[model samples]
Target: GHHNVQRLSTVYTSMGMSNADRGAPLWKEKRDTWASVCDDCHSPRFARENLQAMDEACKDAGMKYTETFKVAENLMLHGMGEPMPKDLAPDWSGQHIWS
Candidate 1:
């Protein structure tokens, strides 16, 4: 549970994993290096399985986010969101999609 919370916290504070260029050689090298480190202690198959599980978790999170965005976009397209706040600072957009 701690690892999950830590992973979520890192994801939340960072730029986010959804937009990361994971197919790049640099990313591949990094992943391979990490896998090697993991394999030093665990079996190669176990390390690979855990890494794949983490990847699946990230994909699951991304799908949930996409679904949420679709719902929000649908609400906006149908003009179903709350009215825009008029008293907010000029820099703040509040709930208005048009702002």
Candidate 2:
């Protein structure tokens, strides 16, 4: 059994937690504080709602969802310029979404 929930950074990143940033996103000890920035870095919501939103955006961007890239690549590709909700990321992922 792996117990590390208090480390919201781990739950948020979906990758694992980091104590010293370690080149990863910064995460505080409070969950409420993180709620604001969670979607920006990465999280379960990203894989869930955010990606779905990106899919729609990709379609709107006149781009097709081809089976050429991994889930991450496709999500990133589709997220570009895709109007994101203010709560999630107003203009955060736009760069990664394009690049």
Question: All candidates' TM-scores?
Answer: 0.60, 0.20
How much is the lDDT of residue 32 in candidate 1? Answer: 65
Estimate every model's Cα lDDT from 0 to 1: 0.55, 0.41
- What is the per-residue lDDT of model 2 for residues 20-96, given as tens digits with 9 covering 90 to 100? 23223443333334444544556656535643463355444433323332454657788853545778853355323
User: What are the per-residue Cα lDDT tens digits for candidate 1 across 1-99?
Assistant: 112333323322232436344445656655665466555567778767876777677667667866787887788789997544777533253322221
Model 2 misplaced stretches (Cα beyond 4 Å)? 1-43, 63-99
Q: Candidate 1, 64: how far from true, in Å?
A: 0.3
Residue 56 lDDT, candidate 2, scale 0-100? 53
